[model samples]
Target: MFATSSPPPSGPWAGAARTEPQPRAPLRTDLLDTLMRLHREGVAARETRRLVPDAIEHRDLIRWEQRAARELRSMFDEVGWPGLDVVGEVGAEAAWWCVLLCDRLTAFQRDAHGLLQDAGERQAAPARHLAYLDDRLLMHHGEPQQFGTQHQLFADGCVEPYPVDNPALVAERRRSIGLPPTACRTAALRLLSLTRGPPLDDHR
Candidate 1:
């Protein structure tokens, strides 16, 4: 098991005995909001499945997955993993993968959402629900990164190149700029492509 690293406390609670657990920090508000949104989307996706609209209705699953992936990417740095500090320069490597995965998922969701929107009434909900739920599942199970592999970095039109001559300096500049790490993209993509398909049971 990864050893737990306790963050230093600056409040009066710091002196409290270990026997009495310190109150947990108020959850990161945005992270909580993202989770809530993801859950709401998941429910809608599930309801759609119950209606069993049609094969085309499966597109909803794609949309939800996409949203989850995007939201997760937005929160990747905030959700620091265990052992990251000791992982040395490679620490942020895993994060990059997740960003990639989320990006792919977002793309998938947009495509599916388009389909769902164009679809008939019976097809709409299921497609959205499926898309969202699948995304939630994928986000929950973010995969480990194979850092040495050929994954690429991305920044969806928000990132700009730095003018540094040194490669390392340039990379650091890129990181400081607006770019989703490689891991986020990889994880989101993996989840979406891996789970892309029709629902088994028709809600109808």
Candidate 2:
């Protein structure tokens, strides 16, 4: 099972306490709207899989996610990085989710994401998602320091692929980016696996 460095918070309200407030920034209405739409679709695709587990629905969701991913890649190509300045708060968050939902990310695209993540962190954009993506790419390449976001599935369930470097500081790293403790994230992933079932393959 997945485990984070911190102790799980107590009580039914524990989860709500972990929610990070979204940063507010001026929106470029058109771009923000586009990003928000993509975000909604991405979320809907996931929800569709959970609510109705039909193979056709799954394939359609995959295609939809892939299309969104490609569009995000194209956007990155035009603009070096979609930071808060370029996309505003909500737009930047949506852009990160679009990339995060991408099933297949190229080396070039991953590198671009890393750059965006770094820039976003520096600019005080919502960066927890970026960190998760960065750590995911690192794990995909068999490198270390994954921030505990990458996992492997087995007959039993999902497990973290590699030990996070400086385990003692995992919570600190997450906290620095306005993320909740690692325990919360790990628990959430476990809940997701239980509800949606493990990935068909170890794509994470």
Candidate 3:
């Protein structure tokens, strides 16, 4: 769910003409490595759950995830967003995955959004990542936006609480940053639900 290409300038800088590539901050290899490992374990834990919902490993996995998320927050506090250049491409992706999967939003939501926006402006991270951050922020604040990663859980199933703003423009937005169309993503989520069954909980 990450974009590879840089997005056009937006926000206060939207009207500025581009001339050169934005410079990136220094890399933090040590922190990047640690985050990468945590991200890998977290993805593994999630996959295990999807494969076997009642697995006894759930508690330990959840604990590991929580601990890793805390570590990530601490790292962010020290070094900001850990953009692709700072953490390397894979590490940045891992950081995004960790943020997305983390159960609590209080830890990194505010600073992460600002840092991600800065990173996006510098072209150190993909535009899609920034969009995802925006979506997460809007969702956390109970507002409506695009790229529907936010959902609510019920006894029967999960439901998207906000319809995308300006449904007609969604595909264009998605395509601008290399994301698949909204319909494709929705169909994929539907197939995943059918295969993996209802999620055990809403971790978002």
Candidate 4:
């Protein structure tokens, strides 16, 4: 389960944790490979499904997502959100991708926001990730989103922001987290995906 004799060296985010409060998270190489593997599986399922949306059944994609969610729940239950310190930057990113693609566990998904928010306070996780999760939860609950990071793609190949709570404040909130403004209209953090033709609620 271990990577090597010693832990991997930290990356550019070595000093990311707060100086006084919120101590660095200890590394857990045992789970690093597992988290990354799950992320790859999820990405692969999405790519293959996208290519033959209609021909393929959703079983493979759903299975991957369910597995990812289950693994993440186990990790979170044992050690809270795995941040850069715990898994290294790439592994931490892999963890986030797993969380983002998790559609089977709505309760765990909501709980993740709090954990990620706390990690963000410690400078252990990205604010943008939390922003995207928050928007997703809001949309899941049938409420307007905050950062407009969720999107809807139409049959005509046009992409639009999911219903946002306050148009006036969205740009400012997005900028605070280093996201592009509503006017800039960058690709959304989460989309219904191109021509997949499933209702957004289906995943929720």
Candidate 5:
């Protein structure tokens, strides 16, 4: 992801960067299925959170994400960024889901961002993915997001962007990345923590 490599697969900051890994010659169906499975689990968890927030505890999600982060870290060791060439379009999208939901692994997620950016440059991955990741990283850091992908959910069922950088350029930035105009996706979640007040947790 970075110049040559990013975090080691063992841990987020366990060791120094190893030499950059290359995509395997043949397609990696194993990794594809693995990533897709992780994506499905994440989707199911989020869906449950949407339907019954109480049923899905924050710790439950964290536990699942720890496993997911480890899986993606191993995949990163196998194929740098899981680009389309390595895992095909569907698998690549699935892989992105893993990266996105691993909020607990901020360092790992941050390292993976560089890999995604490299994949975007090679045209093997979608720029939109990079946009989402970048916004997420900024959100994690409590900084202004470049694109309006991250949001804050209010207790009143109102959603708003977490202060975007260059507000005037949001539309243009979204367009460049093949995203629609600053839409905060609420279909997957009508409202999280319906009873909570002002500082309600945001749906990632």
Candidate 6:
């Protein structure tokens, strides 16, 4: 059902990643329960660590499990899980917040995966060579040809920031987000804004 690390009791959900599919009616329900428990436990651990600074010093593996389990929850939650709705005293907004948080966590999972791949490639490079790329940058330490390839890759990233605003690109992004095509693009710009070298605005 998800990726898991070896060595038992590192976390309560150690074998959860090995869960297999079963008949949709029974298995789906069981999966929903397992996922909910995993998500709750992960969040509880994270909150405890944040409140108690020594939590990680004594329990680094638990902290890692908490992070990984949280990611698994996010991946499943993005599917719009139907079987595990909370019968809450809390309002609908609370459920929505959970959904939003899960979505953000899923994004983090994707970003982390990309980062790890880049790190692996960099580590394999010869002494004087390196490469990396993302929404933010395409850094390299190699010959001109390798730098040129990186430049092309960077340019090909669909959502990478541009120095000069392209109204059409901005409009398309807004449309993807369900905003009106004609709405002010500045709002979308705010989301992609990155600070480098030095802060340019008083808002910093």
Task: List TM-scores for all candidates, in order.
Answer: 0.30, 0.65, 0.65, 0.72, 0.75, 0.25
State the C-alpha lDDT per candidate: 0.31, 0.54, 0.54, 0.59, 0.61, 0.27
Clashing pairs in 2: none
Candidate 4 has which clashing residue pairs, if any? none
Best candidate according to TM-score:
5
TM-score of 4: 0.72
* Candidate 3 segments exceeding 4 Å error: 1-26, 49-62, 149-162, 183-204
The better-scoring model by TM-score among 1 and 6 is: 1
Error of 3 at 201 (Å): 18
Clashing pairs in 6: none
Residue pairs clashing in model 5 are none
CA error at residue 51 for candidate 6, angstroms: 6.9
> Lowest-lDDT window of 10 residues in candidate 2?
4-13
lDDT of 2 at 47: 54
Total clashing pairs for each candidate: 39, 0, 0, 0, 0, 0
lDDT minimum window of 10 residues, candidate 6: 1-10
Predicted model with the maximum lDDT: 5
Candidate 1 lDDT, 47-114, residue by residue in tens: 43322323444466556556666555445434432111322212222222222223324443343334
Q: TM-score order of candidates, best first? A: 5, 4, 2, 3, 1, 6
RMSD of 2: 6.6
How accurate locally is residue 140 in candidate 6, as Cα lDDT from 0 to 100?
15
Q: Can you write out model 5's per-residue Cα lDDT over 34-74, one digit (the tens) per residue?
A: 98798777755555433334434545666667778878888
Winner on lDDT between 5 and 6 is: 5
Sorted by lDDT (best first), the order is 5, 4, 3, 2, 1, 6
Per-residue error (Å), model 4, residue 182: 4.7
> Local error of candidate 1 at 53, Å?
5.7
Question: What CA root-mean-square deviation does each model show from the true structure?
Answer: 18.5, 6.6, 8.2, 8.7, 10.6, 18.0
Q: What tens-digit string does per-residue lDDT give for candidate 2 at 51-115?
A: 23357755755665557766666766666566667776667767765665554444444756766
lDDT of 1 at 169: 45
